[model samples]
Structure formats: C-alpha cells, structure tokens
Target chain A: AQSVAQPEDQVNVAEGNPLTVKCTYSVSGNPYLFWYVQYPNRGLQFLLKYITGDNLVKGSYGFEAEFNKSQTSFHLKKPSALVSDSALYFCAVRDIRYTGGFKTIFGAGTRLFVKA
Target chain B: GAGVSQSPSNKVTEKGKDVELRCDPISGHTALYWYRQSLGQGLEFLIYFQGNSAPDKSGLPSDRFSAERTGGSVSTLTIQRTQQEDSAVYLCASSLPGSYGYTFGSGTRLTVV
Candidate 1:
C-alpha cells in the first residue's frame, strides 16, 4: 500500500531562518511524491512534485523539496522563512501503475509556524 | 473555470438530513477526487473518478456516502443521514491522467447540526 508519514505535527522557525518539514513515503512502484500547502480558509495549493529527474524540485513561493529515494524521504525546505509562510503542509504520494482509479495517499499534515 | 470549482461554499443541515456537494473540474481534465478534512486530521480520501471508469469507492466510509461524475466533467458527492461527525470541509480536486499534481477547489464546508 502507498502511504506517507509526516513525523512532525508542527514546526517552529524564526523569520529569515531556514526551515524544513520532513516527509517519508512507502510505495510499491516508482513513487510520485508531491508537496502541498494550505492556508487559513483556503484549499490546498500544489507546491511541488517529484515525478522524475533532478531530486531537488523548486516550487511556488520560493519553496523546494528534495526527493531522496534511498532514505524514502521527500522533505520540504526553504532557504529563508517569512511570517506569511506559516501554513499547513502536506506530503502526498501516488504509484505510477494504478490498478483501478488514482489514489494519492497523504500524510496527516504539519502545521508550520514561522514566528516573525 | 480556470481551476477546480466546488459549490455551496458553506452548508448547514440538521442531523439525519441528506446533502449533496458539487465539483466542476477544469476543462479537459479527466480525473476528479473527493476528500474530507477535519480538525487536527489531514485530508481523507473519499472517492475518485477518472474518465469513464467506475469510481474507486474503497475510501468511502459507508454506503451512505456516494459520488458520481457526469459526462466526465462534473461530479457530485452525496451523504445520507448526515451526523455531527460528518461536519467538515469537503474538498474536490482534479488532475490529468498521468500528472501527479492535483488542482484543488476552495472546498465546501459542511456543518451537521
């Protein structure tokens, strides 16, 4: 079964400092991992995805994530955080060879708090 | 619409009532998905519709929960005998067949009184 785990429920960081939100996954086939962000009263927005090529993928809002196959991890990172970066982050995964319909398994989500 | 769209931004109904949530996927997108979000809990997959294939309903919690996509573009999720536990934001998303990234709607917030 395909699944994602976000070890930290919440992450705290100061403005202008680097931040990292960890994620790991388990899938039978080649993993199609993605990162999404959700702000207050807003639906999830796609941050980035790892389909193939370059392990580090850049996304909107100056965010990026590194896909590590050996460690089964795809961690979201930002060089310098901002107060507006505070939001909920989710890690999701899917398998390439889908059987019936598509199912993107998601982690419980981590609440990011970038204190100003 | 430019992105996935959901109807009834907010809905309140008494327990035991039935409710229907609608989703309009982006033009030309073939896959649609439904999920529920609750306090402290992440998104829970409800069902998925892809092209003309039968929806994958394994994630549906019970028979009272059902969904259908019409003409492979518009989708509706229905819940019968709604309970307080069902009060949560119902989110809809759509994507291309091979694409892993999904475009999500603002979601419909349902409150079961």
Candidate 2:
C-alpha cells in the first residue's frame, strides 16, 4: 500500500519568513510524490511533483519541495511566506507499479497559517 | 481552455434524500476523478474514470455511493439516502493520458441536513 504522512496538524509562520511543511511516505515501489494546496471552499491546487529527477523540485506560487530517499520524506518549502498563502496542504504518493490502477493516496493534510 | 467544471456548487437536502453531482472534464482530458473532502477524513478518493472505463470502484464508501461517466467526458456522482456524515466538499479532477498534473474543479458542497 502507498501512504503519506504529514506530521504537523498546523504550522504558523510570519509573512516574509521561510516556511516548511513536513511530509513523509511509505510505498511498496518507487514513489511519485506530490504537493497540493486548497483554499477555503475550493478544490485542491497542484503545487509540484517529484517523479525521478533532481532531489529538489520547484512548484507554483514560489513553493518547492525536497525529496529525500533515505529519510522517506518530501517536505514542502517556501523561502518567503505570504499571508495569502494560508491554506490546507496535502501530500500524496502513488506507487509506480499501480500507475494504471490504484488511486493516489493523500495525507491527512496540514493547515498552514502565514501571519503578517 | 476551460478547467474541470462541476454543477450544483452547493446542495442542501434532508436525510434519506438523494442527490446528484455532475462534472464536466476538460475537452481532451481522458482521466476523471471524484473525491470527497470532509472535516475528519480529509480528501478521500471515491472513483476514477479513465476514458470511458472505470477500473477501480474500491474507494466508494458504500453501496449508497455510485458514480458513472459517459461518452468519456461528463460524469455524475449519485448518493442515495443522504446522511449528515456525507456533508462535505466533493471535488472533480481531470487530466490527460499519462499526465501527472491534475486540473481540479471548484467542487460541489453537499450538506445533508
């Protein structure tokens, strides 16, 4: 089974300061990791994904994530946070072997609060 | 190009009532998915449509929950005997074949009173 873990229930950061939302996963095969953000009353918006490339992957809205195989983690990072960036974050993992079958499993989700 | 679109942005119904939510995928997208987001469950996959075939229905919580996609474009999710626990945001997403990024719809908010 492919599963994702977001250790933090919520994260608070000051605007203009760097922010980090932690995520980890467990899978039977190679992992296809993804990050998505959801605003109130809206569907989730895709941020970035890590297939099989560089360790660091950049995404929309000045966000990025680092894929660490040894740690089994893919934490979302942003150098500078904005108040508007406050939203719910989810980490997802899809096993390569089940690419055509099973759906991607998402983490419980982490609420990010960027305060001014 | 338009993004995924879902109908009945918000629906309120009494217990035992049935509701139907519709989704229109992008013009060329071959993959469509339905997911439910609740306060306790977060986001849970309900069903997925690849072209006109749905190979996985394991995500549906119960027999009351059913979905179908027709002509490989439009999809409908029907919930029978609506329960208060079913109150949540139902989202739809579509993507191209072998594409990793998914385009999501605004989502329909279903409130079972």
Candidate 3:
C-alpha cells in the first residue's frame, strides 16, 4: 500500500519567514511524490512532483519540496512566506509497482496560516 | 477545454434522490479520475478511467455509486438514493498518458438534505 502522512494539522508562520510543511510516506517500491494546494471552495492545484529527478523540486508560487528517499519524506518548503500563502496543503504518493492501478493516495492535509 | 471541467458547480437535493455529476476532461487526455472530498478531509478516490481499458472501480464506496465515461471523453458519476453522507465536493481530473500530474476541475459541491 502507498500512503502519505502530513504530520502537522496546521502550521503558522510569520510573513517573510521560511516555512515547512512536513510529509512522510510508505510504499512498496519507488514513490512518486506530489504537493497540491487548495483554497477555500476551490479544487486542488498541483504544486510540484518528485518523479525521478534531483532531490529538490521547485513548484508554483515560489514553493518547493525536497525528496528524501532515506527518510521516506517529501516536505514542502518556502524560503519566505506571504499572507496569501495560507491554504490547505496536501501530500500525495503513487507507487511505481502499479498495485492499485494509478490510484494516488493523499495525506489528511495540513493547513498553513501565514500571519502578516 | 484548457482544463478539466465539471458541471453543476453546486447541487442541493433531497435525500433518496439520485444525483449525477458530470466531467469533461481536456481534449486528447486519455486518463480520467473521480474523487470525493469531504469538508476538511483528504480526497477519496472514486474511480479511474484509462483509455479503452476497463475502469478500476475498486474505490467506489458502495453499490449506490456508479460512473461511466463515453467515447473516453465525457464522464458522469451517478449516486443513487442519495444520503447526507454522500454530500461532498466531487472532483474530476485528467492527465495525458504517462503524465505524473493531474489537472483538476473546480468540482461539484453536492449537498444532500
């Protein structure tokens, strides 16, 4: 089974400070990790993904994530936070073994609040 | 369409009624997916359609839920005898073959009263 875990239910950060939303995963084979953001009443927007690439993957809205195979983690990061960065962040994973036929499992989600 | 499109931005229905949610995936995309999201919860996979292959219906929660895709383009999800528990945002997504990411629709908010 492929699963993702976002440890924090909510994260608060001051504007201009770096922010990190933690995510960990479990998979039987190589994992395809992804990050998505959802605003109120809107669908989730893809941020970035870690396929088979460099350890760091940059995404939309100045966001990026580091894929650590040893730690089984793909934590979303931003060098500086803005008030508008507040939203719900989801971590998802898809296993390469094709056990469930392209079903991507998502984490419970983490709410980020960037205080001005 | 440039992105995945879903119909009936919002729907309110009485309990026991059947509701249909529609989705139009982007042109040329071969993989389509349906997912349900409850308030403040993660997405629950509903079904997946890839090209002409038989869909993977393992994620459908119950017999009351069903879906179909026509010409491998437009898709509809039907929920019969709707209950309050069925109320949630139904999201549709699609991707090109072998694409790692999905383009999602705004989603249909179904409220069963």
Query: What local lDDT score does residue B111 receive in model 2, on the 0 to 100 scale?
Result: 94
Residue-level error in angstroms, candidate 1, position A78: 0.2
Q: Write the per-residue lDDT of candidate 2 for residues B67-108, one digit (tens) a residue.
A: 988888899999999999999989998888888878889999
Tens digits of per-residue lDDT for model 3, A83-113: 9999999999975645334567789999999
- Residues A1-116, model 1: lDDT tens digits: 78899999999999999999999999987888999999998989999998889999999999999999999999999999999999999999985457544578889999999999
TM-score of 2: 0.96
Instruction: State which docking tier applies to candidate 2.
Output: medium
Docking class of 1: medium
- lDDT for A9 (candidate 3): 93
Model 1 TM: 0.96
| Model 2 residue pairs with clashes | none
Over B1-113, each residue of candidate 3 has an lDDT whose tens digit, in order, gives: 98899999999999999999999999998889999999878899999998988898888999999999999899999999999999999999998888888889999999999
Q: Could you tell me which 10 consecutive residues in candidate 1 chain A have the lowest summed lDDT? A: A94-103
The alpha-carbon deviation from the true structure for residue B16 of candidate 2, after best TM-score superposition, in angstroms, is 0.4
Q: How would you encode candidate 2's per-residue C-alpha lDDT over A2-96 as one tens digit per residue? A: 88999999999999999999999998777889999998777789999999989999999999999999999999999999999999999998745
- Residue-level lDDT tens digits of model 1 in B14-47: 9999999999999988989999998899999998
| Model 2: number of backbone collisions | 0
The DockQ values of the predictions, listed in order, are 0.69, 0.58, 0.58
